[model samples]
Target: MENILEKLGIELNAETRLTGDSKFSFNCHSALSCFNTCCSNLDIVLTPYDILRMKNRLGLTSAEFISEYTEPVIQKESKLPFLKLRLGQEGKCRFVAAEGCTVYGDRPAACRYYPLGFGIYKNEEAGDDFYFLIKEEHCKGFGEQREWTVGEWRKNQGIDEYDDKNRVWMEVILNKKLYSPELEPDEKSLKMFFMASYDLDAFREFVFESRFLDVFDIEEERLEIIRSDDSELMLFAHQWLLFALFKKPTMNLKES
Candidate 1:
């Protein structure tokens, strides 16, 4: 997820590239000398999937959770809106504690892939995704006895599901990157993107409670799923953006 990595100040290069078999030593438990240090004074950008899980885990509505815990950011290249975790006093993540992350199970992809940055290199032809290590001076976990290949590390961190759910949102950002240096999103479009991408509950209301159905021809079955399912709705929201932003025809319009 370039969206997550770009903010971490990691760049993709020969030294950073990882094959599935690439291995590294790391162990970050409460016993580390630098325990919970990385969680503070850092830039951790949250993906939409990250918000979906954290908000649901904390039992907060999308808008409520974001308003309370996220700070808005705009990617320089894409001019797109993004949300970073709002660090609390001492510059620590709101969810971070002496015991380590309070929201560990529902942590962001950036947290899940900690000490390793993941990204995709894309062009007009095709794209290649890769991982890179982020060995910071403060981290003693890397000096531990444990070692893992990139694939093993990913599996151990349970990052596959996050990757799967975040794929579409990643595509949206990457798609915009294709037009960078010249990418300037309109205000209304940015609002729409933010609402659809981050504010799921508001987006749900906009779709079912607004005249959205009157304009777009969504099937009844899919409608039922998105009506109550946040995950499905998030997926639907990205698909709608594909149509709204790029005119990708991901959704059909009702014929008069």
Candidate 2:
């Protein structure tokens, strides 16, 4: 862990010691050393799955959540949309509660991967693999007297579902280096990509209000699948985004 963290030029602290393959156990109890310590000083990136679950958990419309809790910006190098959570006063998360996370069941990938982070850097010469562990200044839970492996920790945290939904987004981010310089995106393409990828409610509105649905030759069955499954919706959403950005030809139909 130290070697990788060093390569990334990040610092290490008591809160973030490497226990690679070490058995560690954690649970919510009154005497826990760093009660709610994990809630402080967080910078979490939200995925589409997280947004859908959290909005449902809070009874929020997707558009409402995007406007209130998110800050969307483009990755300067790739011109890609990225979403980060907006912090409340004192730099704490808006969802932090007196006991623990109010949205514990619907927390973002970053929260689910606490004490561990993930990275995937794929390049022409060499590609990086996925990995996770504790980070600097994260010591609040290390003193726990229980034991479990990294794999078990993830299982207990309920991360597999988020991972499944995030797979396509991960592919887009990791494969950025694969795009040729000759295909640099213009302003319009960049704008569409940013909105389609980050701003969920806005995208939904566009789908409903614009001629977008009419422009795509989507089958009735596929539309039904997307309407029923958020993940399928995301997959189709990306297709439209790609078409918008690259001017790729798509099947044509009538507006619903």
Candidate 3:
């Protein structure tokens, strides 16, 4: 998740590097003076699952949510599209209020994992996945007595589900980072990536309304799932990307 950390202007080092068993003391409550301070001036990049959940929670179409509350960014190094949450006036998060986060239950993974950042470093020999602390000077949550392992904190914050849903999307990103330099995506491919990753409604339309099914041999049961389940559709999008971009055998083509 280097893309995420870089977008947030956060750089991890030896001091912040943590394993699953690593322990830290942190807690956030309305009683704290910094209750909602971290909600502002953030560079929260929304994952595909994040957009999926948030749009569903607000009863907004993916296109509407993207248009109204997100700003699309093309990463400089990877040249891949990234969506950042649009802050309201005064740099406050659009979903944050005086009471706290209005959409707390369906909050973005970044917000849910506050004071902790997840990352994966791609080494030539082996990849390294780990978590790290974001010890911002203004965050008093670290001073709290409630200590927990990174694994426990992830469970408590409901990050496991988000991570699981976003796994394939993250793999796509990692593949892009590793190979995009060698092969630059054209405009049409970029548009497909954007739609598949962020605009689920548009992707749904593309799948059902376009010739997508005509070319690919998707099973009937899988098609049924994709027809009604947004999560399943998102996973199908990742598979489509793998087939389209990497020439992976994720799907079979219709025989002539």
Candidate 4:
């Protein structure tokens, strides 16, 4: 998916460009775009909130939604786990409505940003920066009626809060090589990353129906925290990634 985006020239300047001092305006009504034409032809990644909200909107259980709607696939070369939202017959987003987005309030961060998108990159020295830009080919909202600066758009879209929540996962994702460049990941690692990062249904099953709780010790309080905060999950996931890649066993649950 990332490769496709790159091949299509959809660069990931996630933070800097979108959040910077540029100005733009967008409004669906005035823009003469009543429906989602821009949602086609790309693999949109779904966050955990995206899965939950979309499932509830579609009136399906987490398990039911995943099995019926999604497929688990790794991004090429990097072998990173991410969920691709299944598209319709015409390559339209499944949740797109004739009226607008069916799940507007809880739409993914990527969707909320519209024509402007964000990306983050890590330098060899561990420094990270953000970039923003207009998307390719099909986006018509760039010349819409409303107007806003990059900062205004970020504030309006609540991207700062979203970034704050997703930072831990972002850190782990960007720093994969730092933990172990030569780690030969097995099927278990793939499944683990997929469940934890992408598929909410499988993740829920692993947390509730499986012995993940029994084998890896998470305290009641921390478990409660993870239930509420994705940052907490990312922190826990980072620990799991460390164990998975470097083989450093963290057996002392009390230590956390």
Candidate 5:
């Protein structure tokens, strides 16, 4: 989403386009002079899996986490719902402390991808995935001696897992962008999207407490996975969204 980058104050041009093998010098630690600066004044968008991980890490349900720590914002162009991490007083991240991030182990994907921005292009001819350096003027991490290929950075930051988990969600957003004006989702569809994307706890209730299984033919083993594993549930949610929004045959209906 080019608009997302612009909103975050990142300007990308031909010179900044990077492939997986492209090397960059950057390292962030408490020892760095500019450490924790990036955590403040950011419009951090939380993915579904990001919320899942963070909420579980904090022992909070998805609904509670959304209510206490996030603010919902609709993307201006895509008209899609995005849950942004709420900053505290002085415009600093609530999780940021004097030493470093308190929730460092379970930080959001955008925090994990610091100094490197990731995006996908929808062009049929050219390549789709690309990365670019954010090189903020005040970030001294770029001046460090440590160097890494984009792939290495992604691996070191555990970004691959986040990206993998978020792939289907990204596809949905991209599809919405591509079909904008032709496919305008109603208020109910938007609420469904938000629930499936951010409110995992509510989605769980919707799946189990409702007639969802009575209508859809989910296998016993898959149902168990969705019941116990948040990741699997997120995947199921994506499939459900595809079926609900685009009428894709991602799920089969039970026969009467």
Candidate 6:
């Protein structure tokens, strides 16, 4: 399922967007003719956490993976900059193989959520999320014996792990949308955002090898963790973004 929600309940369309309790039948494997068909000619946006998992899984630096496998794009409506998986010949995904995904264990979030679409609607509180079917013509997974509620399918697909890791990055995007007059991201700011959000190695350099240490009063304990841990560094990067992008004072600068 495609989850834009951080917590429970969501996707769209009264007719197709399903509730957490809504049930559906579907399954996919090499036994079916449409086994790997859904992996091609698609627009898959890479979330920050997706990048982290994938680059490390392939033993590649963020810069190398992005340079070789992805292209930068800006959404027309949201104007939020993100990376898209660059399709190879015939509009096929780079990771698709004769059997299945080469990076199946580290597949991107959108890939894991096929045949299910998810969305969100913000109210005053935590907000409501929903799900829907993405029934492609080539897909025959719908005819299989598997029956599941939206929540069940999400659980079976192991999306909670992805959602948990990506929660903070999603917040940054949502916060961007709430800007008073809207934030038209510039070249420099966009580069900074990408570095913080997806380029962990680059961000590491920025933190330890640049004036970042001089400008921010980071605790040594936290520094020690971020230095060796990519996950911790990614979180620390998100904290820096909140301050740099919105001046939220998340990081206290050294007294000048």
lDDT of 5 by residue, 140-193 (tens): 988889999999999999999998999888877777443567766789989999
Mind giving the per-residue lDDT tens digits that candidate 6 earns over 136-242? Answer: 78989999999998889888888888888887777776674434465577788778888998889999999999998888999999999999899989988988888
TM-score of each predicted structure versus truth: 0.92, 0.78, 0.93, 0.75, 0.93, 0.88
The TM-score obtained by model 2 is 0.78
Candidate 3 wrong stretches, greater than 4 Å: 1-15, 124-127, 176-180
Q: Write the residue-wise lDDT of candidate 3 on 175-254 in tens digits.
A: 84436457777788888889899988889899889998898888999989998899999999988888787787888999
Among these predictions, the greatest TM-score belongs to: 5
Worst 10 residues of 3 by lDDT: 119-128
Error of 3 at 202 (Å): 1.2
For model 1, residues 125-194, the per-residue Cα lDDT tens digits are: 5456677888888989989989899999889998999999988877787784436666578899999999
**What local lDDT score does residue 113 receive in model 4, on the 0 to 100 scale?**
67
Model 3: per-residue Cα lDDT at residue 105:
97
Q: Cα lDDT for residue 40, model 6?
A: 84
For candidate 5, the per-residue lDDT at 141 reads: 87
What's the count of clashing pairs in each model shown? 0, 6, 0, 12, 0, 8
Candidate 5, 165: how far from true, in Å?
A: 0.8
Error of 1 at 65 (Å): 0.7
